[model samples]
Target: MSSGMAGANTEQPAGTRRNRTSEAGPAARRASRATDTNTEERVAVWDAVAAYVQEHLLVQKGVWIPTFGSFDTISKDIRTADGTVTLRWPVFQLARNLRAMHHLGSDKDSLPAHREVETLKYSEVAAAASVTWQRGKTCIQSTVSLLSNCLKNGENVAFVLKDIGVLLFEGMSFGIKYYYDFLEKLSGKEKFRKVVFKAPWLLDTLVSRVAPVASLTHSGHLVVFPM
Candidate 1:
């Protein structure tokens, strides 16, 4: 039996012997367990991140929440006696309110609103507003293209939500409205059209309509009137 044991030990390859010894050690077992656990944890985290991005950030309207900031989305529903119609949010609401208040308040109500508008233009206001400038710029460009396509194609109306912007138009008679919303609901739900504009007068009107201040560019933009 002793002779047989000696022969068996001698016949074993050095690499195989080393592997057996290492596998029997406590450190090796611990390392193997840790590698598996790490792999599983990474997979779980990645899956969660993907789910979060798709469900919340991939819609027609997307919202980016700045660090320590909150975002919200709103939709307006119009129900008439005949049927239900949904309008793009923030647009009609802001536009309608501005028109109404402009008629109702006249000069008396305008002064107070102007003061707030002045504050909004201050450097501090733009800096504090939770808007990503680069992102907003991209939104503007995408909206422009989408609207142009709709116009060129002779479509009466079209709405597109890109990562950077939401484009809404109502044919040749009206200008397209663009803005970012912090809120997003389920599919088929129409969001209220609350868009931030680059124009100062429009911004002031938006501020009066309860739209939060957002970062906007200082460069003057030219809008060519249709012939």
Candidate 2:
């Protein structure tokens, strides 16, 4: 008799399943709304930053976000085997921020310290115009604060722009490690002096800190980041 009863159908009624769905509907909707809100905030922040970079940095040397760091370009001439070529790298700096420095263990002191090469301070941060912050519900300051907190957790990545690449923070590494760098030339425009930007080459990071060539510093704006 027990075996026969076990073999009999014990399916839940359709209405019972519907009741469960109805019960979860509100909570599911709440979760969906929360995700959407977070996405909106992130998108808005990126849009503002993109506008600032396109408007100001393209014409000027770099853009400094007061509390955060500076996005300065260091232009240097390297005597390559081919010839002397001018390279521009829009260096994004956060090493100057006290809060961010506190999160990183010991090494990474400045945004992109010219260290690894031992003498290779990759490039220097040439002071540029600082962006005027507009008070808003979702702001850059708070967003960067969140990023610092994330870095403290030991695995996080923040990005400046799609073109520049990512700021990597991971376990097993002491300081900052940036990836996805490229070099492109913009010619024929003296007005609106275009800021040349590049990231560290994958091979460059894997192999050595500095490239195998002598770089001549034509203009040394030595003491940038005055404010």
TM-score attained by model 1: 0.20
Runs with alpha carbons beyond 4 Å of true place in candidate 1: 1-136, 160-170, 174-227
Give the per-residue lDDT digits (tens) of candidate 2, residues 1-227.
00011111232211111112222223233333333224334444544554454344444445666455565555545453445545454455554563446544443223344422111111121111122223222245454554554444433232324333333333423322222232232122331123222221222322112211011011110110000
Candidate 1 per-residue C-alpha lDDT over 26-104 given as tens digits, one digit per residue, 9 for 90 to 100: 4333333333223233223323322332344334233232211111223434554544545433221113332242231
Please give the CA lDDT of all the candidate structures.
0.26, 0.33
TM-score of every model?
0.20, 0.46
User: Which residue pairs clash in candidate 2?
Assistant: 94-111, 95-110, 95-111, 114-121
User: Superposing all C-alpha atoms, what RMSD in Å does each candidate have to the true structure?
Assistant: 27.5, 19.2
What is the clash tally of candidate 2? Answer: 4
Q: Residue 118, candidate 1: how far off, in angstroms?
A: 9.4
